[model samples]
Target: MAVLMEKKFPVEAGAYETAGEVSTTIKRTLKQLGVSAEVLRHVSVACYEVELNLVIHSDGGALTLQVEPDKVTLISQDVGPGIPDIGKAMTEGFSTANEEARTLGFGAGMGLPNMKRNATEFDIQSEVGVGTTITMSFALDMKG
Candidate 1:
């Protein structure tokens, strides 16, 4: 599989001031690449959700974007203080976000569910103290 373009955005924990910048940029990048509207919508939503997760939870992380001939991939890798229960985390309305995040009108606990709903493919792996990683892929209409 050949990648047509790729970029990575760094995210810092508690950086609510610029939480959605990455996703905004990702959406723009996809649009510039001529990605279909449907695929762009899915990627943008999932990207924002995962980006917010990094801002609220991870010590720090990077969100990578890769555009292949037939797909667009987003991989989020974070450091330390990983999830304790993936099942519970995936459940709607369950959140461990701090007051800062909640105060900012975030941490509704719908991040994971929204990501899964928007992405064509989604996978998450987390450890007690080793941090978490999530990968999502959106299939594109390569014919166009």
Candidate 2:
């Protein structure tokens, strides 16, 4: 009784014009698959947060979605200038976004926090000069 679906989308830094497209597609796909509305909202928020992180932070990256009957998984992987201190980065309201990103009403430092809040489980890893990866999962039946 398990169903599986997977998808991947590319995200370019400073791609404001198309920043949320991937997340939107993911939302649509989940809706078509009959995912519950609550689960869909959580997935949509987390997906957009990760997508925006790539658009505003990384040089480039990919957002991946893996949906199973019990849970939905999101993995965001990006290249270059990785976080030096994940502890600080995770702190709500902490941001390192550039002026351009800030000017767009983004970079409020809410992306990571929002992602964590929306997902049932969350993990992040980074290496300076290398890259970063964030993994998040939402339980399909939970009241989250």
| TM-score of structure candidate 1 | 0.95
Q: List model 2 lDDT by residue over 14-104, tens digit each.
A: 8988889999999999999999999999999989989988998898999989988899999999986799999889888899988988888
How well is each residue in 1-144 modelled by candidate 1, as lDDT tens digits?
A: 998888989999989999999999999988998988878888998999999999999999999999898899999999968999899999999999899988888889999999998888899999978989999998896221
lDDT for 130 in candidate 1 is 92
The C-alpha RMSD of each candidate to the native structure, in angstroms, is: 2.2, 1.4
Clash count, candidate 1: 0
Question: What is the alpha-carbon RMSD of candidate 2 to the true structure?
Answer: 1.4
lDDT for 130 in candidate 2 is: 92
TM values, all candidates: 0.95, 0.95
